[model samples]
Target: MEAVMSLLVGCFFAAGVYLMLSKAIIRILIGIVLFGNAVNLLIFTAGRITREAPPVIAPDMDRLTGIAANPLPQALILTAIVISFSFFAFLLVLALRTYQELGSDNTVQMRVAEPEGDTLPPLGY
Candidate 1:
């Protein structure tokens, strides 16, 4: 199971990176989302998935008698989900605005900051 999950994690990361390298804004946004999910899965796998009891100690026992699921990874993944969602939303809005203003989502064409021209800027003052 762990091996399968590990392979999935790698695939997600690779696909995310490939999408991110594209010139389209939408693809980049999707890549970001995929990358975030991959990270979350990685954290979950690292925490170790086992059918164990909750991390609670009985009154008769000084310590947990059996394996207990680690709570830290769950907490971290929860927080990451919230943060990543907000980030993705912001990026999506920003991309939409860029497309509206520039009339293009292609990175090659959206050169508002530096218009395409054959002439070069004057050198050193």
Candidate 2:
């Protein structure tokens, strides 16, 4: 199972990077989402995959006696999910606004700040 998850994580990272390299804003957004998921999975896998009991101890026991699933990765992944969602939302809104203002989502065409035919600045001050 760990091997499978590792493979999947690798695939996700690859796809995310591939998509991020595209010129389209939407593709980049998707890539970011994928990348976030990949990171979460990586954290989860690093925590060790096991079928042990939950990380809880009985009141009568002095401490946990057997192997228990690690809770840190789960907590981290949950927090990361929320953060990534908000980040993705913000980026989506920003992309929409840029599209509205420029009427294009392609980075190559969205060049209002630096129009073509402008004289190049002096090579040296």
Candidate 3:
């Protein structure tokens, strides 16, 4: 199972990078999402997948007796999910605004600071 999951994570990362390298803004956005999911899955796999009991102890016991599921990774993944979602949302909005204003979604064509056919500015020391 771990091996399968590892392979899946690798594939996600590969696909994400491939998409991110595209000139299209939409593909980059999707790549970012896939990258975020890959990270989350990586965290989960590192936490050790099992059917063990939850991380908790009886009132009488001071420490956990048996192998219990780790909660740290779960918590971290949850936080990451929320953060990634908000970041994606912000990027989507920004991309939409850029597309609306520039009428293009290609990074190469969305040149605002240094447009084509313009003379290069002089370099200052």
Candidate 4:
């Protein structure tokens, strides 16, 4: 199971990178989302999946007796998910605004600072 999950995570990362390298803004946003998901899955797999009991100790016992699921990774992943979601939303809005103003999502065509056919600025100090 772990092996299969690891393979899936690798594939997600590869696909995310491929999408991110594209010139389209939408693809970049999607790639960012996919990469975030891949990271979450990677963290989950690293936490070690087990069929053991939850991480709780009996009232009488001072420490957990048998196996207990690690809680740190789950917490971290949850936090990452929330943060990623908020960031993705912000990026999406920004992309939409850019598209509205520029009428294009291509990185090359959105070069307002350096319009096509313009002479290069001087580089002297």
lDDT of each: 0.94, 0.97, 0.96, 0.96
Task: List the candidate 2 regions with Cα displacement exceeding 4 Å.
Answer: 117-125
Give the per-residue lDDT digits (tens) of candidate 1, residues 5-123.
89999999999999999999999999999999999999999999888888988998899877798999999999999999999999999999999999999999987668887567888
Cα error of candidate 1 at position 42, Å? 0.6
Q: Model 4: clashing residue pairs?
A: none
lDDT (10s digit) by residue, model 4, range 44-110 = 9999977878999899999988978899999999999999999999999999999999999999899
| Model 3, span 1-125: residue lDDT tens | 99999999999999999999999999999999999999999999998889989988899999999989889999999999999999999999999999999999999998898899999888886
The local lDDT score (0 to 100) that residue 2 gets in candidate 2 is 97
- In model 3, the worst 10-residue window by lDDT is 116-125
| TM-score computed on alpha carbons, candidate 1 | 0.88
Please give the lDDT score at residue 119 for candidate 2: 85
Query: Would you list the clashing residue pairs of candidate 1?
Result: none
Model 2 score (lDDT): 0.97
Of 1 and 3, the candidate ahead on TM-score is: 3
Stretches > 4 Å off in candidate 4: 117-125
lDDT of 4 at 80: 100
